[model samples]
Target: MNYTLDFGPVVAGLPDLLRGCAGTLFLAVVGMAIALVIGVVGVVLRESPVRPLRWAVIAFVELIRNTPFLVQIYFVFFALPLIGIRLAPTPTAIIALGLNGGAYAIEIIRGGVQSIHKGQVEAGFALGLHKRDVFRFVVLRPALRAVYPSLTGQFVMLTLTTSIASAIAAYELTSVAKLIENESFRSFEVYGTITVLYFLMSWLMMRAFGLVSRRYFSYPVR
Candidate 1:
Protein backbone atom coordinates (compact mmCIF):
# COMPACT_ATOMS: atom_id res chain seq x y z
CA MET A 1 0.00 0.00 0.00
CA ASN A 2 1.22 3.47 -0.92
CA TYR A 3 -0.14 6.84 0.21
CA THR A 4 0.75 10.26 -1.15
CA LEU A 5 0.17 13.17 1.24
CA ASP A 6 -0.61 16.60 -0.16
CA PHE A 7 0.02 19.57 2.13
CA GLY A 8 -1.21 22.27 -0.22
CA PRO A 9 -4.79 22.59 0.96
CA VAL A 10 -3.76 22.69 4.59
CA VAL A 11 -1.31 25.48 3.80
CA ALA A 12 -3.98 27.34 1.86
CA GLY A 13 -6.33 27.12 4.81
CA LEU A 14 -3.98 29.04 7.12
CA PRO A 15 -6.38 31.96 7.40
CA ASP A 16 -9.14 29.65 8.51
CA LEU A 17 -6.81 28.12 11.04
CA LEU A 18 -5.98 31.58 12.40
CA ARG A 19 -9.65 32.40 12.72
CA GLY A 20 -10.26 29.15 14.52
CA CYS A 21 -7.33 29.83 16.82
CA ALA A 22 -8.75 33.23 17.69
CA GLY A 23 -12.11 31.69 18.44
CA THR A 24 -10.48 28.92 20.44
CA LEU A 25 -8.50 31.42 22.49
CA PHE A 26 -11.60 33.53 23.06
CA LEU A 27 -13.58 30.54 24.24
CA ALA A 28 -10.74 29.39 26.50
CA VAL A 29 -10.40 32.80 28.13
CA VAL A 30 -14.11 33.15 28.69
CA GLY A 31 -14.45 29.59 29.84
CA MET A 32 -11.52 29.88 32.25
CA ALA A 33 -12.95 33.06 33.75
CA ILE A 34 -16.27 31.32 34.25
CA ALA A 35 -14.54 28.31 35.71
CA LEU A 36 -12.59 30.48 38.14
CA VAL A 37 -15.73 32.19 39.31
CA ILE A 38 -17.51 28.91 39.76
CA GLY A 39 -14.56 27.51 41.68
CA VAL A 40 -14.52 30.44 44.08
CA VAL A 41 -18.24 30.19 44.62
CA GLY A 42 -17.97 26.47 45.23
CA VAL A 43 -15.13 27.01 47.69
CA VAL A 44 -17.06 29.64 49.60
CA LEU A 45 -20.11 27.45 49.72
CA ARG A 46 -18.04 24.49 50.77
CA GLU A 47 -16.73 26.52 53.67
CA SER A 48 -20.07 27.97 54.66
CA PRO A 49 -21.37 27.36 58.17
CA VAL A 50 -24.46 25.95 56.52
CA ARG A 51 -23.85 22.23 56.24
CA PRO A 52 -26.52 21.55 53.64
CA LEU A 53 -25.11 24.17 51.26
CA ARG A 54 -21.63 22.66 51.54
CA TRP A 55 -22.91 19.19 50.73
CA ALA A 56 -24.92 20.55 47.78
CA VAL A 57 -21.81 22.18 46.35
CA ILE A 58 -19.83 18.99 46.89
CA ALA A 59 -22.46 16.96 45.06
CA PHE A 60 -22.55 19.36 42.16
CA VAL A 61 -18.79 19.17 41.79
CA GLU A 62 -18.81 15.40 41.96
CA LEU A 63 -21.57 15.02 39.39
CA ILE A 64 -19.93 17.31 36.85
CA ARG A 65 -16.41 15.98 37.27
CA ASN A 66 -17.49 12.37 37.05
CA THR A 67 -19.51 12.76 33.84
CA PRO A 68 -18.26 12.98 30.30
CA PHE A 69 -17.87 16.46 28.84
CA LEU A 70 -19.22 15.34 25.46
CA VAL A 71 -22.50 14.34 27.04
CA GLN A 72 -22.67 17.65 28.86
CA ILE A 73 -22.10 19.58 25.67
CA TYR A 74 -24.69 17.58 23.77
CA PHE A 75 -27.20 18.15 26.53
CA VAL A 76 -26.50 21.86 26.52
CA PHE A 77 -26.80 22.15 22.77
CA PHE A 78 -29.74 19.82 22.20
CA ALA A 79 -31.77 19.46 25.37
CA LEU A 80 -32.36 23.18 25.88
CA PRO A 81 -34.57 23.48 22.80
CA LEU A 82 -37.18 21.18 24.32
CA ILE A 83 -37.49 23.62 27.24
CA GLY A 84 -37.70 26.63 24.89
CA ILE A 85 -34.26 27.79 25.88
CA ARG A 86 -31.67 28.73 23.30
CA LEU A 87 -27.96 29.36 23.47
CA ALA A 88 -25.65 30.36 20.70
CA PRO A 89 -22.89 27.89 19.96
CA THR A 90 -20.27 30.07 21.64
CA PRO A 91 -22.07 30.35 24.96
CA THR A 92 -23.03 26.72 24.95
CA ALA A 93 -19.45 25.75 24.30
CA ILE A 94 -18.17 28.11 26.97
CA ILE A 95 -20.70 27.05 29.54
CA ALA A 96 -20.07 23.38 28.97
CA LEU A 97 -16.34 23.74 29.17
CA GLY A 98 -16.54 26.20 32.03
CA LEU A 99 -18.76 23.99 34.14
CA ASN A 100 -16.69 20.92 33.45
CA GLY A 101 -13.41 22.70 34.18
CA GLY A 102 -14.84 24.37 37.23
CA ALA A 103 -15.71 21.04 38.80
CA TYR A 104 -12.12 19.90 38.58
CA ALA A 105 -10.83 23.27 39.75
CA ILE A 106 -12.93 23.02 42.85
CA GLU A 107 -10.93 20.05 44.05
CA ILE A 108 -7.67 21.60 43.00
CA ILE A 109 -8.48 24.81 44.81
CA ARG A 110 -9.75 22.99 47.85
CA GLY A 111 -6.46 21.18 48.12
CA GLY A 112 -4.63 24.49 48.00
CA VAL A 113 -6.91 25.99 50.61
CA GLN A 114 -6.40 23.02 52.85
CA SER A 115 -2.63 23.31 52.53
CA ILE A 116 -2.66 26.77 54.11
CA HIS A 117 -1.41 26.94 57.70
CA LYS A 118 -3.90 27.79 60.45
CA GLY A 119 -1.61 30.54 61.66
CA GLN A 120 -2.35 32.73 58.66
CA VAL A 121 -6.06 32.90 59.39
CA GLU A 122 -5.53 32.97 63.15
CA ALA A 123 -3.17 35.92 62.76
CA GLY A 124 -5.76 37.80 60.72
CA PHE A 125 -8.35 37.17 63.41
CA ALA A 126 -5.84 38.14 66.04
CA LEU A 127 -5.61 41.55 64.35
CA GLY A 128 -9.45 41.94 64.55
CA LEU A 129 -9.98 41.58 60.81
CA HIS A 130 -13.35 40.51 59.56
CA LYS A 131 -13.86 37.02 58.11
CA ARG A 132 -14.13 38.45 54.61
CA ASP A 133 -10.96 40.45 55.00
CA VAL A 134 -9.06 37.48 56.43
CA PHE A 135 -9.98 35.25 53.51
CA ARG A 136 -9.37 37.97 50.96
CA PHE A 137 -5.99 39.11 52.27
CA VAL A 138 -4.67 35.77 53.41
CA VAL A 139 -6.46 32.60 52.30
CA LEU A 140 -7.44 33.69 48.80
CA ARG A 141 -4.07 34.97 47.68
CA PRO A 142 -1.98 32.10 49.03
CA ALA A 143 -4.38 29.44 47.90
CA LEU A 144 -4.62 30.78 44.38
CA ARG A 145 -0.87 31.28 44.25
CA ALA A 146 -0.22 27.74 45.42
CA VAL A 147 -2.48 26.38 42.73
CA TYR A 148 -1.41 28.75 39.95
CA PRO A 149 0.58 26.13 38.05
CA SER A 150 -2.25 23.61 38.22
CA LEU A 151 -4.74 26.24 37.11
CA THR A 152 -2.67 27.08 34.03
CA GLY A 153 -2.20 23.42 33.24
CA GLN A 154 -5.94 22.93 33.42
CA PHE A 155 -6.47 25.95 31.17
CA VAL A 156 -4.12 24.43 28.60
CA MET A 157 -6.01 21.17 28.77
CA LEU A 158 -9.26 23.07 28.22
CA THR A 159 -7.72 24.76 25.20
CA LEU A 160 -7.08 21.34 23.70
CA THR A 161 -10.53 20.20 24.69
CA THR A 162 -11.95 23.08 22.66
CA SER A 163 -11.46 20.80 19.68
CA ILE A 164 -14.62 19.06 20.79
CA ALA A 165 -16.49 22.24 19.94
CA SER A 166 -16.04 21.29 16.30
CA ALA A 167 -18.43 18.40 16.88
CA ILE A 168 -21.36 20.79 17.28
CA ALA A 169 -20.21 22.77 14.25
CA ALA A 170 -18.57 25.47 16.34
CA TYR A 171 -15.88 26.15 13.68
CA GLU A 172 -12.77 25.63 15.78
CA LEU A 173 -9.33 24.45 14.63
CA THR A 174 -10.38 20.84 14.17
CA SER A 175 -13.35 22.02 12.14
CA VAL A 176 -10.99 23.90 9.83
CA ALA A 177 -8.87 20.78 9.53
CA LYS A 178 -11.95 18.78 8.64
CA LEU A 179 -12.73 21.25 5.91
CA ILE A 180 -9.23 21.01 4.49
CA GLU A 181 -9.30 17.23 4.66
CA ASN A 182 -12.63 17.06 2.86
CA GLU A 183 -11.45 19.39 0.09
CA SER A 184 -7.99 17.91 -0.39
CA PHE A 185 -8.68 14.29 0.56
CA ARG A 186 -5.53 14.22 2.70
CA SER A 187 -6.51 13.22 6.17
CA PHE A 188 -2.99 12.27 7.24
CA GLU A 189 -1.42 15.52 6.17
CA VAL A 190 -4.27 17.66 7.40
CA TYR A 191 -4.43 15.99 10.77
CA GLY A 192 -0.69 16.01 11.06
CA THR A 193 -0.78 19.73 10.58
CA ILE A 194 -3.40 19.99 13.26
CA THR A 195 -1.25 18.00 15.69
CA VAL A 196 1.67 20.34 15.10
CA LEU A 197 -0.52 23.39 15.55
CA TYR A 198 -1.97 22.08 18.77
CA PHE A 199 1.48 21.30 20.08
CA LEU A 200 2.74 24.77 19.25
CA MET A 201 -0.28 26.42 20.80
CA SER A 202 -0.01 24.38 23.98
CA TRP A 203 3.71 25.01 24.20
CA LEU A 204 3.10 28.73 23.96
CA MET A 205 0.54 28.49 26.72
CA MET A 206 2.97 26.59 28.95
CA ARG A 207 5.65 29.25 28.47
CA ALA A 208 3.25 32.09 29.16
CA PHE A 209 2.00 30.39 32.30
CA GLY A 210 5.54 29.79 33.49
CA LEU A 211 6.30 33.44 33.08
CA VAL A 212 3.20 34.41 34.99
CA SER A 213 4.12 32.08 37.84
CA ARG A 214 7.58 33.59 37.99
CA ARG A 215 6.20 37.11 38.15
CA TYR A 216 3.35 36.46 40.57
CA PHE A 217 4.50 33.51 42.64
CA SER A 218 8.20 34.28 43.15
CA TYR A 219 8.83 31.30 45.40
CA PRO A 220 12.26 30.81 46.87
CA VAL A 221 14.64 29.46 44.21
CA ARG A 222 16.57 27.42 46.74
Candidate 2:
Protein backbone atom coordinates (compact mmCIF):
# COMPACT_ATOMS: atom_id res chain seq x y z
CA MET A 1 0.00 0.00 0.00
CA ASN A 2 1.95 2.95 -1.31
CA TYR A 3 -0.24 6.04 -1.09
CA THR A 4 1.75 9.14 -1.95
CA LEU A 5 0.81 12.21 0.08
CA ASP A 6 0.68 15.59 -1.63
CA PHE A 7 0.58 18.98 0.12
CA GLY A 8 0.89 21.15 -2.96
CA PRO A 9 -2.86 21.71 -3.09
CA VAL A 10 -3.05 22.43 0.59
CA VAL A 11 -0.19 24.93 0.32
CA ALA A 12 -1.87 26.58 -2.64
CA GLY A 13 -5.09 27.01 -0.68
CA LEU A 14 -3.45 28.36 2.46
CA PRO A 15 -4.10 31.98 1.57
CA ASP A 16 -7.80 31.38 1.11
CA LEU A 17 -8.01 29.45 4.38
CA LEU A 18 -6.09 32.23 6.14
CA ARG A 19 -8.61 34.77 4.91
CA GLY A 20 -11.36 32.52 6.22
CA CYS A 21 -9.53 32.35 9.54
CA ALA A 22 -9.70 36.13 9.69
CA GLY A 23 -13.43 35.94 9.17
CA THR A 24 -13.73 33.38 11.95
CA LEU A 25 -11.78 35.65 14.30
CA PHE A 26 -13.95 38.64 13.48
CA LEU A 27 -17.11 36.65 14.12
CA ALA A 28 -15.76 35.35 17.41
CA VAL A 29 -14.66 38.79 18.62
CA VAL A 30 -17.97 40.41 17.77
CA GLY A 31 -19.92 37.52 19.21
CA MET A 32 -17.95 37.60 22.46
CA ALA A 33 -18.52 41.32 22.84
CA ILE A 34 -22.23 40.79 22.43
CA ALA A 35 -22.13 37.88 24.86
CA LEU A 36 -20.39 39.93 27.54
CA VAL A 37 -22.98 42.65 27.27
CA ILE A 38 -25.81 40.16 27.53
CA GLY A 39 -24.18 38.36 30.43
CA VAL A 40 -23.68 41.52 32.46
CA VAL A 41 -27.17 42.77 31.79
CA GLY A 42 -28.72 39.41 32.55
CA VAL A 43 -26.90 39.16 35.85
CA VAL A 44 -27.96 42.66 36.80
CA LEU A 45 -31.54 41.94 35.92
CA ARG A 46 -31.56 38.61 37.67
CA GLU A 47 -30.52 40.37 40.85
CA SER A 48 -33.16 43.08 40.40
CA PRO A 49 -36.43 43.16 42.33
CA VAL A 50 -38.52 42.53 39.26
CA ARG A 51 -39.66 38.90 39.04
CA PRO A 52 -40.51 39.07 35.33
CA LEU A 53 -37.04 40.22 34.42
CA ARG A 54 -35.42 37.43 36.36
CA TRP A 55 -37.72 34.87 34.79
CA ALA A 56 -36.98 36.22 31.31
CA VAL A 57 -33.27 35.84 31.79
CA ILE A 58 -33.71 32.38 33.20
CA ALA A 59 -35.85 31.34 30.24
CA PHE A 60 -33.31 32.64 27.75
CA VAL A 61 -30.45 30.82 29.45
CA GLU A 62 -32.33 27.59 29.61
CA LEU A 63 -33.56 27.81 26.02
CA ILE A 64 -30.08 28.27 24.61
CA ARG A 65 -28.36 25.77 26.83
CA ASN A 66 -30.90 23.05 26.22
CA THR A 67 -30.89 23.21 22.44
CA PRO A 68 -28.39 22.23 19.79
CA PHE A 69 -26.33 25.13 18.51
CA LEU A 70 -26.71 23.90 14.94
CA VAL A 71 -30.45 24.15 15.24
CA GLN A 72 -30.17 27.65 16.64
CA ILE A 73 -28.05 28.83 13.74
CA TYR A 74 -30.36 27.19 11.25
CA PHE A 75 -33.32 28.93 12.79
CA VAL A 76 -31.55 32.27 12.75
CA PHE A 77 -30.51 31.91 9.15
CA PHE A 78 -33.57 30.26 7.70
CA ALA A 79 -36.60 30.66 9.89
CA LEU A 80 -36.10 34.39 10.44
CA PRO A 81 -36.32 35.02 6.73
CA LEU A 82 -39.88 33.76 6.71
CA ILE A 83 -40.83 36.36 9.27
CA GLY A 84 -39.41 39.14 7.10
CA ILE A 85 -36.37 39.39 9.33
CA ARG A 86 -33.69 38.32 6.97
CA LEU A 87 -30.02 38.76 7.86
CA ALA A 88 -26.97 37.96 5.84
CA PRO A 89 -25.16 34.77 6.69
CA THR A 90 -22.27 36.39 8.49
CA PRO A 91 -24.45 38.53 10.74
CA THR A 92 -26.72 35.56 11.37
CA ALA A 93 -23.74 33.49 12.44
CA ILE A 94 -22.54 36.22 14.75
CA ILE A 95 -25.95 36.60 16.35
CA ALA A 96 -26.38 32.89 16.87
CA LEU A 97 -22.92 32.55 18.37
CA GLY A 98 -23.55 35.54 20.62
CA LEU A 99 -26.87 34.25 21.91
CA ASN A 100 -25.48 30.77 22.47
CA GLY A 101 -22.40 31.96 24.32
CA GLY A 102 -24.30 34.59 26.28
CA ALA A 103 -26.50 31.95 27.89
CA TYR A 104 -23.53 30.19 29.44
CA ALA A 105 -21.93 33.51 30.25
CA ILE A 106 -24.97 34.52 32.28
CA GLU A 107 -24.46 31.51 34.52
CA ILE A 108 -20.72 32.09 34.83
CA ILE A 109 -21.17 35.74 35.67
CA ARG A 110 -23.94 34.90 38.12
CA GLY A 111 -21.58 32.65 40.02
CA GLY A 112 -19.06 35.45 40.25
CA VAL A 113 -21.68 37.92 41.42
CA GLN A 114 -22.85 35.53 44.10
CA SER A 115 -19.28 35.15 45.34
CA ILE A 116 -19.17 38.82 46.39
CA HIS A 117 -19.78 39.31 50.11
CA LYS A 118 -22.46 41.52 51.56
CA GLY A 119 -19.77 43.28 53.58
CA GLN A 120 -18.16 44.48 50.39
CA VAL A 121 -21.41 46.02 49.19
CA GLU A 122 -21.80 47.76 52.53
CA ALA A 123 -18.23 48.95 52.36
CA GLY A 124 -18.88 50.57 48.99
CA PHE A 125 -21.75 52.54 50.56
CA ALA A 126 -19.57 53.44 53.49
CA LEU A 127 -17.03 54.90 51.09
CA GLY A 128 -19.77 57.27 49.86
CA LEU A 129 -19.84 55.68 46.41
CA HIS A 130 -23.04 56.07 44.44
CA LYS A 131 -25.04 52.85 44.21
CA ARG A 132 -24.43 52.75 40.48
CA ASP A 133 -20.74 53.32 40.90
CA VAL A 134 -20.58 50.71 43.62
CA PHE A 135 -22.20 48.14 41.40
CA ARG A 136 -19.94 48.96 38.50
CA PHE A 137 -16.63 49.25 40.30
CA VAL A 138 -16.82 47.12 43.40
CA VAL A 139 -19.25 44.41 42.44
CA LEU A 140 -18.94 44.06 38.68
CA ARG A 141 -15.23 44.49 38.23
CA PRO A 142 -14.17 42.07 40.92
CA ALA A 143 -16.80 39.61 39.84
CA LEU A 144 -15.47 39.73 36.30
CA ARG A 145 -11.96 39.21 37.57
CA ALA A 146 -13.12 36.18 39.48
CA VAL A 147 -14.81 34.71 36.40
CA TYR A 148 -12.36 35.76 33.70
CA PRO A 149 -11.00 32.29 33.14
CA SER A 150 -14.44 30.76 32.71
CA LEU A 151 -15.59 33.58 30.51
CA THR A 152 -12.62 33.17 28.21
CA GLY A 153 -13.23 29.46 27.98
CA GLN A 154 -16.76 30.16 26.81
CA PHE A 155 -15.44 32.62 24.24
CA VAL A 156 -13.09 29.95 22.93
CA MET A 157 -16.03 27.60 22.57
CA LEU A 158 -17.87 30.28 20.65
CA THR A 159 -14.90 30.53 18.30
CA LEU A 160 -15.03 26.81 17.66
CA THR A 161 -18.78 26.92 17.18
CA THR A 162 -18.31 29.35 14.32
CA SER A 163 -17.53 26.28 12.28
CA ILE A 164 -21.27 25.64 12.15
CA ALA A 165 -21.61 28.85 10.17
CA SER A 166 -20.38 26.89 7.23
CA ALA A 167 -23.81 25.28 7.11
CA ILE A 168 -25.24 28.64 6.16
CA ALA A 169 -22.49 29.32 3.67
CA ALA A 170 -21.02 31.92 5.98
CA TYR A 171 -17.47 32.95 5.16
CA GLU A 172 -15.26 31.20 7.73
CA LEU A 173 -12.35 28.80 8.03
CA THR A 174 -14.37 25.61 7.85
CA SER A 175 -16.35 26.89 4.88
CA VAL A 176 -13.12 27.76 3.10
CA ALA A 177 -11.70 24.35 3.85
CA LYS A 178 -14.79 22.67 2.46
CA LEU A 179 -14.50 24.59 -0.76
CA ILE A 180 -10.82 23.73 -1.04
CA GLU A 181 -11.49 20.09 -0.41
CA ASN A 182 -14.17 20.00 -3.07
CA GLU A 183 -11.99 21.71 -5.64
CA SER A 184 -8.73 19.90 -4.90
CA PHE A 185 -10.30 16.49 -4.22
CA ARG A 186 -7.73 16.25 -1.41
CA SER A 187 -9.95 15.98 1.64
CA PHE A 188 -7.22 14.64 3.90
CA GLU A 189 -4.71 17.35 3.10
CA VAL A 190 -7.24 20.18 3.26
CA TYR A 191 -8.85 19.13 6.52
CA GLY A 192 -5.49 18.30 8.08
CA THR A 193 -4.27 21.83 7.41
CA ILE A 194 -7.56 23.30 8.69
CA THR A 195 -7.29 21.29 11.91
CA VAL A 196 -3.85 22.81 12.57
CA LEU A 197 -5.14 26.31 11.83
CA TYR A 198 -8.00 25.90 14.30
CA PHE A 199 -5.71 24.63 17.04
CA LEU A 200 -3.29 27.52 16.53
CA MET A 201 -6.10 30.08 16.53
CA SER A 202 -7.54 28.67 19.76
CA TRP A 203 -4.11 28.76 21.43
CA LEU A 204 -3.56 32.34 20.36
CA MET A 205 -7.00 33.33 21.62
CA MET A 206 -6.30 31.85 25.05
CA ARG A 207 -2.94 33.63 25.22
CA ALA A 208 -4.56 36.93 24.34
CA PHE A 209 -7.16 36.44 27.05
CA GLY A 210 -4.42 35.67 29.56
CA LEU A 211 -2.66 38.91 28.75
CA VAL A 212 -5.88 40.86 29.05
CA SER A 213 -6.70 39.24 32.39
CA ARG A 214 -3.28 40.08 33.80
CA ARG A 215 -3.56 43.68 32.71
CA TYR A 216 -7.10 44.27 33.95
CA PHE A 217 -7.40 41.97 36.95
CA SER A 218 -4.04 42.31 38.67
CA TYR A 219 -4.50 43.17 42.37
CA PRO A 220 -2.04 44.75 44.73
CA VAL A 221 -1.02 42.67 47.73
CA ARG A 222 -0.98 44.09 51.21
lDDT of 2 by residue, 78-174 (tens): 9998999999999999999999999999999999999999899999999999999999998999999999999999999899999999999999999
lDDT of 2: 0.94
Per lDDT, the best of the predicted structures is 2
- TM-score: model 2 vs. ground truth: 0.97
lDDT of 1 by residue, 1-222 (tens): 988777888889888888888888888888989999998888989989999999999998988978888889999999998999888888899999999889888888888999889998999999999999998878988999999989889989999999998878776788888888888898888898889888988999899889988887877778
lDDT of residue 42 for candidate 2: 92
RMSD of each: 1.5, 1.0
Against the unseen true structure, what C-alpha lDDT does each candidate score? Answer: 0.88, 0.94
lDDT, residue 100, candidate 1: 87
Give the poorly placed runs of model 2, Cα more than 4 Å off.
Answer: none
Please give the range of 10 consecutive residues that has the lowest summed lDDT in model 1.
167-176
Q: For residue 172, what is the lDDT in candidate 1?
A: 78
